[model samples]
Target chain A: MSTTEPKRRGRRPNGADTKEALLTAAREVFAEQGYDAATVRAIASSAGVDPAMVNHWFGGKEGLFTAAVQIPINPAEIVREVLEGPREQIGERIIRRFVTVWDGVGGGQFAALIRSVAGNEQAVTMLREFVQNVLFNRLVKVLGVDHPEMRVALCGSQLIGLGMARYVVRIDPLASADADAVAATIGPNLQHYLTGDLQLLA
Target chain B: MSTTEPKRRGRRPNGADTKEALLTAAREVFAEQGYDAATVRAIASSAGVDPAMVNHWFGGKEGLFTAAVQIPINPAEIVREVLEGPREQIGERIIRRFVTVWDGVGGGQFAALIRSVAGNEQAVTMLREFVQNVLFNRLVKVLGVDHPEMRVALCGSQLIGLGMARYVVRIDPLASADADAVAATIGPNLQHYLTGDLQLLA
Candidate 1:
């Protein structure tokens, strides 16, 4: 049988639009009902699409979540930017990039994210994925370091703790202080966490 | 002042028992409904006492919360124990104590406490009080070192982060890890955080 080549392969005019619509709906549903509580049918209904479409496009809720929360910054790209120059200075870049994301999304997004994690099981899974895959995994690979997992987890904890105190809990001074000010205060410790001389103590 | 002194001096016979009962009720309510949602009336009702009893006994809700979550271990006692021995070994003792409290409480109490922090405003306030007054305040006083407040806060962040990862999220290895093992892994860093040389980088 003679086969014809596909008409247009690069970009589907409507595909991006549908994906965005579904993602927005999925985020709201997950936020409201949590992971176990939100259903595919509910998400599809909210998106004004057939339930079968979600399965066809996203594979399932897990896939939809991964797609929805994917940060615009590419992990490989971030690793390159962060790891360039002497390893000693990497911590500042890391902190600055993290701060940029927080400022770009604003406090409300972080609050919503924290709420989702507290309220929903799926949200925790998603959070673990975002931290482990999108951020920590790449950083570990780039650092090519020992205790990579613990180091990544430790960095995550430090950053998250700072975020919780500054944004979620709204602790005095930290909450009210300028973003650059905080980055200056906490950045070096984080850098040390990533590539510091821990073996010296050992 | 003289007239009031007599009233204060002539205490009720069962005052201690009643106060204990109220505290028990307050803990249950605070654990279940968190601080803000757990009304004084409800706690009193649970305790089978009038709402006025809470006022008569603990001053108000905030005071009641202080009593509810108070740990028996004194920070002064802890600092004394640490400082009594070699400064280098203080880290191990500190880590041991932390593990003891976390294990003693069982995961459920901590889960309830964390859930309360997530769900209730009053719980957050009460938690802040407990962290600030009973925990951090004591640590700061006993450490008797420079930047005591910041040091204490940072130490708290590490401990709380460890708890969140271990108990709430149940991160493996660490979650099921033996108490002593965990103490060894995290203790030295925490020790450095508490009393090590942390002069600002040039």
Candidate 2:
């Protein structure tokens, strides 16, 4: 039993070591190259792990990205899922998913993430690139919208603001409000940003 | 002249002493009673200074609140000014003023404020109350909106998100974009929150 316990502990640490190594390497690569440009093979090579280990540990590049970035949700997966639905309802879907996922984690992690981003320059850069390019930008391109840069910024602002108000600041009504209600309240504005006519600011 | 230096130094320290005392007391008082309820007399009394010192040192209750909160601009003054304009243009006015005041102070202060809010529970509560009650909630009431709570939250989210994107994270295009352009791009959305029909979340 003692011998088997040692082996069991040894195997888990070995697995954990690989995952740690991958996360370390992935943060550097993703911040430097962004989500679309950074690849599984490159990250694995950087971590000195087998290419398959990316899948084994993080399920894929998206999961790895989520872990490395320290954001609890799989933003890539959420984006893909959010886009799969009717374009008109995308705003509601994003808000609902956001509230559900963050609330699921007890919402404190959102504040922690904000603290990390506020204090760390690297985290800020990674999140900035992720919010602008990896997430909202991708959504903008898929929609084939004009002024993609502005749209992404607008969307980023509202979404991040909603998270701050509800989770971090715990603003009443909005803070205590349910996900469906939040979606209904803020969804239309988000939809307007996504699909409505916006005057070009530049 | 050399002997007179003692008197000059004595007078400046006396002035600074009053200012310092007021600020210390104001922080505690404002945090405790909020903007409207916390009177200049109370803060001055708490600091062991005369009520006139509130205006003489910091301009008035509004200015004292500004200094006490550590926010660079007078939110009360800004609110008063923004409301003086046509209601339809209020959103644009707000974006323009927000960008101008923060930008005037070089915008870095916004990040500093965020860092403070994220790390300190007291700062979080103060800001939450300020944004919801002192700022947006007042606006909702002026407009006589149906769902005042939701409107305030929606507006709070977008405005804070805009600040985070433009000033803190420094997200592209949005970050570098000119204020007029930003106002035009984002104003309509703000107007909707201020005056538009929003489906209630509760």
Highest TM-score against the true fold, candidate: 1
| CA lDDT, candidate 2, residue B59 | 86
Per-residue error (Å), model 2, residue B18:
6.5
lDDT of 2 by residue, B105-162 (tens): 6776677667667766667876887888788777777778787887787788888899
What lDDT is reached at residue B170 by model 1? 55
In order of listing, the candidates' clash counts read 2, 0
> Which fraction of the native contacts appears in each prediction?
0.11, 0.88
Residue A71's C-alpha lDDT in candidate 1? 44
Best model per lDDT: 2
CAPRI-style docking class of model 1 based on DockQ: acceptable
User: A1-202, model 1: which lDDT tens digit per residue?
Assistant: 5386565554366666667778889877865654556788999899987787677779998788666655444677778888887788687777677667776766645555665566456667777667766787788776787777666665766666666665565554445556565556566667766777543223
Q: Give stretches of model 1 more than 4 Å off.
A: A1-11, A25-74, A176-184, A196-202, B1-66, B71-95, B141-149, B191-202
- Evaluating just chain A, the predictions reach TM-scores of 0.80, 0.68
Q: Give the TM-score of candidate 2.
A: 0.71
DockQ per model, Cα = 0.25, 0.57
